[model samples]
Target: MNRRAFATLDRPYKNKTTLDLLNSLAVMKFSKIKPLVSAFPTLINMNNNAVNCLIKKTLFPVFCGGETIKQTIPTMRKFRESNIKTVLALAIEADVDELERKGTDAVSYTRKMVDDLKVCIDGASKFSDNFMAVKFTALVPPGLLKRWSFNLKKLQDHFELVSTDGLLSRSNVSLVQDAFPNLDASIFDKCDELSFSDITAAVSIFGPNAHQLILNDPLSVDADDIETFQLLLNEIKDICEYAQQKKVNLIMDAEHDYFTPAIDDIIIGLARKYPQGFIYQTYQMYLKTGFERMKRDLLRLEKEGVAMGVKLVRGAYMDHERHYAKMNGLASPINETLKQTNDQYNAAVEYLIANNVPLFIASHNEDSIAKACKLIGPNSNVRFGQLMGMQDSITFKLAQGGYNVYKYVPYGPVPVVMQYLYRRAQENREMMNRLDKDKRYILTELKTRSLFK
Candidate 1:
C-alpha cells in the first residue's frame, strides 16, 4: 500500500480559503434555482415511466452503484482498491405488502452480498470496505406505522378524558381533533346519546377490549406490531453480527420525526448490546432542530455511558414536511435558510469530533466535508460519506487526500430502486433553493479538468 497519499494529512484541508469560496458560491441565487427548475418536474412525477427511464440511465449511474449485485461488483472493486469504504443497500420502499415482500428480498440479497464482501475482505484485508444500510420503511409501511401511533395516542387521550370527568373538556376535544381533524359533523351530532365508554367503543376501530388496533395492512402471522418491528431488528442484527465477524458495519437510515424516536431507541439499544462493533443511530442535519437534537442525544448517551455512531445527512424530505405543515397550519421541521443548515452541519461535525465519537458525515457539500477534514486532526474516526453517483469528485478527492471515506452504494432492480432514485432527485431539487456550493464546485472542477487537458 502506498502510504504516501495517506501520510501528508495535517495542514492539508485546514485552509479557510475554500470555506470562504464555498460561502460565496452557496449564497448566490441563480446557481440554486437552475437545478431546482430542472429537477422539480422529474421529482413531482417519480412514478412516470419516462422519469424511471431517466433515473435508470442518468441518475442511477450517478447516485447508485448499480441495479444488481453483479453490476455493483466493478464499482465496489474500484472503491475497494482506492481504500474507500462502501455501504451497500438494496433500495426498496413501498406499501405494507410490497415492503414485507421486499424485506424477504432484502434478507436474501444481503446474505449473498455479505458472502461476497466477506470473500473480498478476506482476500484483500485492507481493500474491501463494504457494509449494509437499510431503511425502516423498506421493511414496513410508513402510513401503517403512523396510523398505529395515532390510534395509540387516541386511546391514551380517551383514558385520560374518562378518568377526569363525565364531560369531555376542551383538551379532550383537542385530542380528538388532532387524530381526526376531518371528523364528520353527523358523527359529532350523534355524540349526545353516547356515554364515555359507549363513545370509546364506538370510536374504537378494533373494539374497546383490544389493547391495539390491527394496523392498516394487518400482519399475516401472530406477530404484533412491536414484535414485527423486533423481527426486522433481529434480521438486521443477524446480518450485522455476521458482518461484524467479517469487520463490516451496518447503518440504519433515518426516517421522519414521527417514527424516528421509536427507530432511534431501537438503534440505541442495539448499539448498547453490540458496543464493540455495532454502531447505529442516524442524524438528519437538514432539520431546523437537528443540532439541538444531536446535542440532547450526545448528553443522553454520555450520561448512559454508551458509544454513539451516527450517519449524518443534510436531509431529503424537507419539501414534504414543509408542505404538510403549511397545509395544516403548523411549524415545519426544515431550517429557515441554507446558511442555518450549513452552519449547524459544520457545528455538529465539530461537536462529534470533540467528543471523539465515530461518525459518518454523508454529504456532497465541499465546504462541510472540508471543514470536517480540518477538524479530524491527523488520525481520527470521522469518515466522509457520499451517495455513489452524485458526488464522486468529492468522495474520490477526499479519499485520495487520505481521509477515510465511504460511498453509500445502493443496489436492486428497477422497481425497488425507484424509491432511492426518487429521494436522490428530491434532495437535489430541494437543496437547489438552498445551496449553490455543489453546482459551483462542479463548474470549477470542469474548468480545471479542461485546463489540465
Candidate 2:
C-alpha cells in the first residue's frame, strides 16, 4: 500500500495551539503515574472539591466534551472549526444489580434514559457535523441482556451440532431436532419455519443460522425473559424512531461480550425495520471472531437489502474481559496479541472499503488510519473517528487531508463519567508513547514561536 500521504506525522499537529499540545502531554504524563491513576476513580466520585477541580481542569477538558449537551457545545464548535465531526454519547450505563434493585422501577429508569438520549439526538440535530451515540447497556438491565445472549448462544450451539455440511433447507429441522432431542417447541417451530439455503455463504461464515433467526424477528429468549426483552426493544425502537424523525444518525456503542450478542441481534433487527441509514453498529476487532461476524452481517445485510452502517474499533475491554474469563474458568475471547488485533482491524477496513459500504474508522493508530485512507482514496463514504482528547495529531491530519473525520465526544457530569475518563487515561498511555516523537516535534515548534510563550 502507498503510505506516502500521512508519512509526515508532524503535520498532524501543525495547526494545534501550543497549549493544546501541552495539555495533551499532561493527560499522558498524569496517566503514567500508577498511584494517581489508581486513585482517580474513587477520588473523583467522593465529591472532593480539590480532586474534582484538578480533574475537571486537566482530564475533563482533555478527555470528555462536558456534562450536558449545552455544556458540550464549545467543544463541538471547536471540532467543527477544524473540519471534523463529533459523535456525541452520554456517559452512563447500568449494571445488573442496579436494574434488579429497581425492579418495576426499571421502566422508570429506562424512560429517563430515553429522555436523556433524545436530548443528545436533539443536540446532534442542531449541528451538521455532530451525530449521536447510545449504549444498550444504558437503556435496559444488563442482566436481561445476558439472559438473551445466553439463550441465543445455546440455540447457536444446538444448530451447529445438527447443521449439515451442504445447503441448509427447512427440511434440516429434522436434523436439528435429531441432534437436540428435547428442543423447545418454540425453537422447533422457529426452526421448522426458517431456511438458510439461499443466504448460504453469509450464514455459513458465522456458524449456525440460529442467531440469523433474530434478524428474521423470531427471537427465542426464555419465556420469563420475553416480556422484559420486548420492553427493552421497544425502548430502543422509540429512541431510534425519534432520531429518524430528526434526520439525526445514531451509532449504537458496543459493550463487553456479555451483552454484545444480544446487542448485535437487536441492531440487526432495528436495521431490518429502519434501513434508511440512521442506525450504525460497532465491531470490536480485538475479539478473535470479530472480523467474521462483521463479514457475515455485511453479506447478509447486502443480500437482504438492509441499509446499515459500521464503526470499526480495536476494542477497549481487553483487561476486564481476560480477567473475568480467568476468574470464571471460561476461555478468553480477546485476540492474544496486538498484531492479531491490528490484522483483523485492517482486514475489516479493507473489506468495507472494497465493498463501498459506509464505515466509520474509529481509531488513533496512524498506520491503520493511513492504510484505510489508501484503500479509500477519494471515497467520501468512509469516515475516520478518534476520541475527543487523545490523538490530536492524527485527527487533525485527517481533517487537513479533507477526509471525513469525527471526534468521539463523551458528555456527562465528571463524577458520572469517572469510569469513562479513567478508561481513556489507561488506554491513552500506550498510544501517547507511540506519538512521543510527534510530541517532541510539536514542542520544538512551540519553542520557536512567541505565541507559545
Candidate 3:
C-alpha cells in the first residue's frame, strides 16, 4: 500500500498551541536523549507549579484522558467525531505501598478499587462501545500474590525431584514419599481437600520463607486464598455484569509474568461465564508461549461454545520479565527477539480472524496493522487499537479507512498516573522514532489544506 494511503493526518492538532507542544514532545522523544526522557517522571513528582502546568498542557492532552472522567469526555468526543472509539482505562497503578499508605484496612482497599472502577465504567459507557481495560492487581492485594508465588515456587521445587509423571493429581502427591518422609501422608491424601484457608494456615506454621516445608501443598487449594480469590472474582464479575448492562465490553489487562498465570485463569473463567464476547482478555505476543496459549484458549472456548474476545498486544513488560527471570534463576518467558514476537503476533491475528472470533488488533506496527486490515477485509467483528498518544498516523489511517479503531485513553489524577506515563515512554522508543515521519505527514496535510485558501 502507498504510504499516504495510510497517512491521512486530518486532525493533527486541535489548535496551533497543541500542535507546537506535540511537535516539541515528538522531537524530544525522537532524539532518545536519556536524561530528557527519564526526567519526566521525576519532574511529575517534583510537584512544582510550573512543571505541573507544563505537563498538564503538553503531556496530558496528548496521552491521558484527564484527571477525572468528566474531564475526559471532550477528548472522547473528538475521537468519536473521527469515527474512532475510545477504550477507557483508569490510569492508576496498583502500587502496594501506595495502597497501604492510603489505608490499612483490606475492606477499605477493596471498596476504593471498586468505586474507582465504577467511575471508569460509567464514563466509558457514555461514549464508546468498546472495552474498558482494568488490571486485576488493582482489585487484589499485591502481597497475597507475592505470598502465593513464593509458596508455589517452593512447592514446585520440592516436586522437581519427585516423579510426577507429568500428572498433577493426588496420586502424584503421594509420590512425595522420600521428599518429606516425616510429614504426614494424610497431608498428601488431603491434597484434594485443601483450600485457600488451609494455605493461609500453613503460611502461619511454615512462615513466609519456609522453602523446606511443603507449606500449603500446591497440589491442593488453600481455603483463605480461595476466599480472597473468590472476592476478586466477585468484584470482577460485578464489573463485567455492570459493563454488560451498560453495553461496554470489559478487558482484563495483562501484567507481569509473575501474576499472569492466575490472571489468565481468572480471565478464562470470566470468559466462560459471560461468553457473548462481553468480557475479554489481553494476550501479550512478546511471550514465547502467547501464540500457543491463544490457540489453546480458542479451542477451549470453541468446545464450550463461547465466543472468545481478545486484545492482542506486543506486550509492555519486556524489561521487567527479563530482569525478574534472571534474578530468580528461572527461564525467561519472553520471546528471544522482536522478530519472533511479530511472527507470533501475526499468526495469532490470522488464527483469530479465520475462526471468526471477536478480536481487537491492539498494535501500532505498520506491517501488523496492514496484515490485520487485509485479513479483516469487510469484517466488523475485528477492531484496531492503539494507545492514546502514540501512533496517531496508524490510528487515524485505520479509522479513515472505514475500519473500527479504538484508542486506549487513560485518565486519572496526574500525580497518580505518572507511572503509566513513564511506562508509555519506556515502551514506545521505536514508535517515537517515527515521530519525524509523522511530522512530515502533518506538514504535507497542512500544505494541502492551505491550498484551499
Candidate 4:
C-alpha cells in the first residue's frame, strides 16, 4: 500500500498533528510510573484527565469512535470502504459488583454494541464473520474468581478442622461428615446430633474462610456458578450465531495466564458444541509453551471436528509476569528474548496459515506480517489486525496491498481509556526496548512525517 492509502486508514483529520501528539504522548506515558501507582485509584487520578483529553483530541480520532454509539459508525465505515475490517470493542473494566452482575452487564453491552455495529456492517457488507472483540473478564466477573479462590482457602481450613476435631459433634464437623460419610463414622456416632440452629451457628462462627475452602476443593463446583457460566456461553453462542448469520467473525483475546485456562476451557467447550469458525482463541507466541499449547489446541479442535480460529500476538503482560516471577523467585513465563518471541510468533502464524484454520495476525512487526503474506497461499483464511492508534504504517499498507486487515477500535469512557492507554504505552515501550531497531525506525518515521509535504 502507498503512503496515501496508509494515511487514509487514519482519515477524517485534515493534518497529522493530533496523530503526532498521540504518538509522542504514548511514548512518554508508558515509561512514567510513581511509587503510589500500585493502586488503580492513584494511576487513574494521575493520568485520567490528561489521557482522556489526549484520547478525545488525538487518539480517539485515530483509534476510537467518539465516546458514544453514534460517534463510532463513521470511523468503522471509513475502514469498511477501504476493504479493511473493523473490530469494535467496548472497553469497560471496574472493581464493581460480583461476577454474575458484571457478566450480565457485559452480555447486555455486547448485544447493544453488536446491534449498533450491524446497522453499518449490513448496509455496507464490509464486516467479516465477526465485528467485535470480547474480553472474558467482562463476562466472567472478577469477584467470582476472587470468591472462588477464597472458597479454596476455606475448604483447606475445613480439612484441618475435621482432622483434629475428629467429628466430635455434628455442630463441629457435620458438613464433612455429610460430604464424606465413609471416613470413620465411629468418630461421629457418639457425638451429639446437633440441631440445625447449632450447625448454622458453628459454621457461621468457625468457618470464616468457608468460601476460600470451598474454592480449594476441586469438586466444589457450585450449580449456581455453572449456571452463570452457562448463561455466558449462551450469550456467546447468541453472538456467534448472529456473527455467522451476518458474516462476522469474533476473535477471543488472550488474557493473563491466571485467567487463560478458564478461557481455554470455555473456548474448547464452545468449539465442540459449535463446529463453525465463528470463535477464535489467541496465542501469544512469546511464551515458551505457546507453540506447544497451540499445537495441542489445534489437534483437540480437529479431533472434535470443529474449525479452529486463532489469533497471534507477541503478548502484553511480559513486564508484570517477569516482575512477579522475580519477586517470588519463580521462573518467568515470558520468552527470554525478543528474538525468541519473534521466532515463535512467526512460527505460530505459519502453522495456522498452513493448517487452513481461520487466522488473524495481531502484531505491529513488519517482518512477521510479511511472513504472513508469503505463507498465506491462494484461498487462505487470514486477516491481519493492529491497534487503531498504534502501527498505522503496517495496517494501512497491508490493507492497500489487498491483504485482509482489521483495526482494533476501543471505545468508552475517559477513565477506562486511561487504563487501556497505560497498558498500550507500557507494551510499546517494552517493545521498543526489545526491538531497538524498531524504535529507531519510529523516530525516523516521525521525522519523515514531520517533513512530508
Candidate 5:
C-alpha cells in the first residue's frame, strides 16, 4: 500500500477554518494531558470550569457527533458529502443507580431504555441504511447479567458432565434433569427443547473445552433470575424489531469476557429469529480464541440458515481483562503479543471475505485496512470503519478510493462521555502520532493556500 495514497489532511480539513484546523492540532498535542487530569480526581474537579470550556471548543467537535441525535444530523451530512457513512453511537454509560432503584421491577426502566434507543435508531436511519450501535450493557442492567452469568456457569458445569457421559437423547430433558435437580420438571419442559444430537452438533462446532450448552437461548438460570433475563431479552428484541422495521442495521457492542457469552447468545438468537442480516455482533481480534469463536459462530449461523453480520475490531478492555485475570489467577484470554493479534485480525478478515459474510472492518491501522481492501472484491459486502475523531486520513482515503467507509460517531452529554473520550485517547496512540504528522501537513497546506492567494 502506498503511504501517500492514505494522506488525507487537505481533503478532510476542507470545511475547517484555519482556527478549526489549528485547534484540532492543539487538541491532539494535548491529548496526553487528559489522562493525567483523569488520574487525579481533585485536580480534575478543581479545574473543571476551565477544562470544560477548553474541551467544548477543541475535543468535543472532533470526537463526538453531538449531545443528541438531532444535533448530529449536520455532521452526518458532512460524511455523506465526502462519500462516507455514519454509524451514530449513543455513548451513554449504564446508570447503575437507576437500574438499582428499578430492582426486579424493571418494566419502567425497560420501557425508558427502549424508547431512548428507538429515538437514536430513528434519527440515525435518516442518514444511512446502517444505523446506531447500542451497548447491550446500556440497555440491560449489568448486575442482572452478572447474576445470570453466575447461575449459567453452574448449569454449564452440569452440562459438561452430561457431554462427557455421551448421552444422545430425544430432548435435553436428561441434561436439564441432571443440571437442575432442584427446579420443577415443568420448567425444563418449558425451556427451548434442544435434543442431545443438537448439543453434540453445537459442541462439535465450538470445538473442545468450549463452555457447554451455555448458548441455550434461554439459559438455565433460576426461576427468579428468569424474569430479569426475559425482561432484558424483551428490551433487546424491541430495539432490534424497531431497527429492522426502519431498514437499519444494528451492531451490538461487545463487553468484557464475563458478559460476552451471554451477549453472543442473545445476538445469535436475534440473528436466527430476525435473519436477513439485520443485526451484527462485534468480534474483538485481540482474544486468543476470537478467531475460533468467529469461525464457530459463522458455521452455526450458516447451518441454521441465518445470515451472519459482523464488525471486526481489535479488542478493547485489554488492561481490564489482564488485571482481572491476574487477580483471579486465571490464564489471560487475550493474545500475548501485538503480532499475534495482527495475524489473527488479518486472518479473520480473510475468513469473513472467503465465507462471503457481511462485515464491517473497523480499524485505523493502514496496513490492516490496505490488506482488507486488497481482499475485498467489487461485490464484497465489506466496509471500512474508523472512530469519529481519529483516523481522518484513513477514513477519507478509503472513501476517495471508492471503498465503503464509515465513521463511528459517538454522541452524548460531555460529562457522561468523559470516560469515552479518555479511552479514545488511550487506545489510539498510533493515530495520535499520525495527528502530529497531520499538523505538519495542515501547516504546509495553509502556507500553500497563502502563497496562491
Candidate 6:
C-alpha cells in the first residue's frame, strides 16, 4: 500500500476553502458533547430563523448536497472532478414521521413523494454511473412494516423471506409448496401447535400462499396487509422499472430491523428482476447477524443464478437499534463493541471479495479499506463509497488509486432533513477520535495555506 495514499495531508484537504474548514471544525467540535448530540434534533426543530440560517450557511453547505435537484448539480459536478460518482438520496421523500404530520394530506403527500422520486430518476438518468437511494417508508405504513417483519421472521425459521430469484424470467411460473429444497412440506403443516403461529397461521395474516412465502411470499394473496403491501410493491416496481428503462441504478437502503425483513424481501424480489447491478441492496454490518445475512444472500443468489449488487455499510442505527432492543426487552442486535462491528464488517467485505461479488464497500475506516484494497485484484467488480463531507481524504485517496468511488450526497430541506443531520451528529459523537483526526487535517491544511502569514 502507498502510505501517502492513506495519509491525512495527501492533498484532498488542501483544496477545502477556509469557510468549509471552519464549518467542519465547528461540527466536529460540537460532536464531542454527548448532551448536544442527544439534543440535536430538538435544536434543529426549535424553528428559529437565525439558527436555521446559520446552519444553512455553515453545516448544511459542508455536509449536504443541497435542498433541491438544481442545488445538487454543483455537488455532483464537484465530486465528478474528483473522479467520484454521486449516490443522490432524497432525504425528505421517505420520512414516515413527516408523512404522519401531513395527516389529512397523507395520501397526496405520498403521491407527491413518489412524483419527486420520479423527478429524481429523470434527473439522475442524465448522469452515467450515478445512482439514487429509495426508501418506501412514506409509501408503506411503518407499523405495518413492523408487523410484516414479525410475521415474516416467524416464517423465516423455515427459509429466508425473499421470493427466490428468477421469479420474473419465466412465463408459466407457478407458486410452489416449498421455497427451500428438501425442507419437508410438513414444516408448513405445523402452524397451530407451535403456539407462536406457523406458516399456515401466517396465511390468515399474510394470506393463503403463505406456505411457500419467504417474507414476501405468494404472487397472489387474500389479506388486508397484502392489499396495502401491494400498493407499496407497485410503487417500487413502477419507480424501479422506470429507472431501469432510463438506464440508471437504484440502491435500496436498509432500515431498522423492525422494518428491514420486509424491505429485504421486496429488494431481493426486485433484485431478481433488476439483476444487472441496476438494483443494489445495502447490508449494515454492525449487527451481530450481519455476516450471516450476507453469506445467506450470496449463497441464495448463486444457487438461483442471479447477479449480486451489494453495498456494505458500517451501519447508521447503532444507538436507535440498541435503545429499541433495550426498551422491548430483546437482545441488543448491535455488536457489543466497535471492534466486533469492524470485525463483522471486514468479514463481510472479505466474503464478497472472495466470492467475486459485485459490491460497493461503503465505510470510512482506512484499515478496513486498505485490507480490501490488498485482498482484491485490480479487475475486481468492486467500488467504494463514503458520505459527502465526511472522510474526504480516504475517499479521494481511493479515487486517486483509480477505483470507482461514490460520495453519498443527501439532499432535502434543512428542517426536513433534520433526522439525517441528527444521525450524522450521532455518528460524529460516536466517532470522536475520528472527528479529532479530521479537525487536525483541516487545521493542518489551514496552516499550510498560511492565512496567519
Best by TM-score: 2
Report the lDDT tens digits of candidate 3 across residue range 1-453: 222334343554333344644454554454376776768668767877787677677667778978999999888887888778999999765643444322235545766788888888888888758668898778766555544555444444555555344234544544444544434444435555333223223333223312234344554334455455545555666777888888888878888766664565557667767888777788999998788767766676675687768889999978778998999898999999889999999999998888888888899788888777766655358888888877777777777667788999999877777777777767655555566556655565555556322
Least well predicted 10-residue stretch by lDDT in candidate 4: 204-213
In model 1, residue pairs whose N, Cα or C atoms come closer than 3 Å (at least 3 residues apart or on different chains), thus clashing, are 62-389, 63-389
Better of 1 and 5 by lDDT: 5
Those runs of model 6 whose alpha carbons end farther than 4 Å from true positions after fitting are 1-9, 93-110, 157-222
Better of 1 and 6 by lDDT: 6
Which candidate ranks first by lDDT, i.e. highest?
2
lDDT of 4 by residue, 1-453 (tens): 322322233222212354553454454343444332334345566665664575566444545665755677677776677666777776654332433454456557545655654453353244444356766665565444434433433433455566443223545564655553323333334447532222222322122322222332443434355445555555656656666677766667776654554466566656666677777888888778789768866775685477868888988777767886788797898888889999999888877777788888899887788767776765668888888766655665676667778888777666666666656655555555333443344455555666432
| Tens-place lDDT digits, model 1, residues 1-453 | 322343243332122134333333333332246665456455545667776675566555656667667677777786766667787777754443344323454556445544544443343233344557756565444544454445544544554565455455433454544444433324435454333343333433232222333333332112254444433455556655766776666678877655554455456556666777346567888787678667766665665577767778888777667887798797887889888888888888888889888788888787787667667766677777887645555665676676788878777666567656666665655556323434455446544545223
Q: Which of the two, 1 or 5, has more TM-score? A: 5
The total of clashing pairs for model 6 equals 2
Model 4 RMSD, rounded to 1 decimal: 11.0
How much does candidate 6 score in TM-score?
A: 0.83
Give candidate 3 misplaced runs (Cα > 4 Å).
1-31, 44-50, 95-104, 149-223, 449-453
Candidate 2 lDDT over 132-224, as tens digits, reads 888888876787677666655655566656656533456566665553343323433434344332323223212333333332223333433
- Candidate 2: C-alpha RMSD to true structure equals 4.9
Q: Candidate 3 overall Cα lDDT vs. reference? A: 0.69
lDDT of each: 0.59, 0.74, 0.69, 0.59, 0.70, 0.70
> Scored by Cα lDDT, where does model 5 land?
0.70
Model 4, residue 434: C-alpha shift (Å): 9.8
Residue range 302-330, candidate 6, lDDT tens digits: 65577868899989988889889999899
Local error of candidate 4 at residue 445 (angstroms)? 8.9
Model 5 CA deviation exceeding 4 Å by range: 1-17, 33-51, 95-104, 151-221, 430-441, 451-453
* lDDT at position 425, candidate 5: 61
In model 1, which regions exceed 4 Å deviation?
A: 1-54, 95-127, 141-144, 147-223, 230-233, 430-453
Whole-model lDDT for model 4 versus the true structure?
A: 0.59
lDDT of 6 at 173: 20
Q: What TM-score goes with each of the models?
A: 0.66, 0.87, 0.80, 0.68, 0.82, 0.83
Give the Å error, residue 84, model 6. Answer: 1.7
